[model samples]
Target: ILIDGALQNLDFSSGSVEFHNLVIERELNQKVMGGTEDEIYIFYMRFRRGIRVGIRLSKKILLIQLEIDSGFRNGTLGLLGTFNDNQNDEFVLPNGTVFISGASQTDQNLHLYGLHWRTQEISSLFKYDGTQSWSSINNLTFVPLFFNPNLTAFIPNATIRRYAQDICYGEGLNDPTPEQRKPCYFDFSVTFDADIANDTEKTLKTIDTAKKTL
Candidate 1:
């Protein structure tokens, strides 16, 4: 999913862009892959700048794999969010899966392709900025935005809250009381520095046009 108004041009002369603070989460229905009916969810959030350049592709891929279970095959794809003023193109994968992809100056939008009954299903991908405003690519409904409490299977609730608060407020800080703290918001940002200068604009326009027909 691409976030609106999150795109920016960098001064890097190497034809590469850097993204910071990207949060990617995926929820896979286990039944689709011959597993239990429960959903297998994975989330990745980067606090520092993440390299989107060519040479670091391997490292990035490794980072993604570390967060998710490797037993789930064909689920290795990662989501990209960006900011573009115009609508973007709808991508058709080799497996007959199709979905729209785009970016904007402040929002990131994505509609992920899934498999159901051997056919492709598209999930609504949404984005929220630092302000916590949300937007979706289509009229797609999403699961709850909050983290899955089950992620910390054996961890206690107090420990989870402490970790969450530390990550949200900053490290090396005392925990705050319930009244003094608020739920943490997941923020994401993206940058594209491809040689194609108008990629962002073109993608947005394409997405807008496609939306009318639906």
Candidate 2:
């Protein structure tokens, strides 16, 4: 799905969708120090078997080009989606994406958040990944991203990503506490780096944040 941009043409003959090479944001210029399409943030993603292997965006590129300065903020961010299994007590994002715990954060009392691709809701921004963030599916990666008001973008730190991947892929501790009698969830931070821009275009960056446990 290509958000923040308009498709000028579309074709579906080759078992794939094709665009006319014109994304609306590309037509705008910000030379006059005012309003322009250049200020609009664009996020382009192509999914393959539930994994986002490719992405195209304007802001992330701009940030690298400008090199305005960047650093990873404290805290881990995770990516969450709809739980597709027959599990109960699931959390749903505003966009109707349900999430199951394919991986765990380092923090036992992890915060969870519901997310829609493009939303202005606080739920989309942050939430605690508590008990409600679990799914019955085995060996599925559930990565999540948290919104950082300081950076004005959603991102996750490397520590959390590795931890989540380990737990989700069955590479971490598998013991569960007697109270819950279930495997323990991993914990990590949502820290990320950014060029520190108020404009959405310069702040938004693509990342493979969090994942679910097996």
Candidate 3:
């Protein structure tokens, strides 16, 4: 929930594209552990050049896995492309419980995504390329512009696998556990096309009239 404007206040301006299409959606709610499990998240997109993604899952869920991690700093965890709604497997090992820190102090280099779905609505459409810099912490002069949508989930119950051991036994342990509990609630919305290849059919009828005005 740190989305720092990739066009946060979109307006097709009477139709005449220039934003370059992108519509990522999310509404994933996991109910503790439920049989098959595999989930990881890190979506920080504010345009870094790489677009063309169309993934919609919510017919009661079934998108087994999708991995796309590019330009991530701290030991370059590279592994790109792996989308499936049914077949094509192989790409599920965040076993370290997948942890990613804030772009390692700017120069923004992170797009780590590994999602295995059983569904509660998770949509996608990609195409990004913001001067591709694959950031590698090279004496950061000043790179302070960020976008965010970080999510992480790996199921097997035990209160959702003790979220990193309840943040290391509740840090300074004020000693008073058992009260925090949340199970499901998520909502999403993202529709864009400031420049749809110079007006592709009136930018899909102005993105279907701005998604029926939401």
State the C-alpha lDDT per candidate: 0.34, 0.30, 0.30
Per-residue C-alpha lDDT of model 2 across residues 101-126, encoded as one tens digit per residue: 44543222234442233333343433
* TM-score, candidate number 1: 0.20
CA lDDT, candidate 1, residue 54: 15
Report the lDDT of model 1 for residue 100. 45
Q: Name the top TM-score candidate.
A: 1
How do the candidates rank by lDDT, highest first? 1, 3, 2
Task: Please report how far candidate 1 places residue 19 from its true position, in Å.
Answer: 30
Candidate 3 local distance difference test against the native: 0.30
TM-score of each prediction = 0.20, 0.19, 0.17
- Which parts of model 2 are misplaced by more than 4 Å? 1-26, 31-56, 61-140, 147-194, 197-214
* Between candidates 1 and 3, the lDDT winner: 1
Question: Sorted on TM-score, highest at the top, how do the candidates line up?
Answer: 1, 2, 3
Most lDDT-accurate candidate: 1
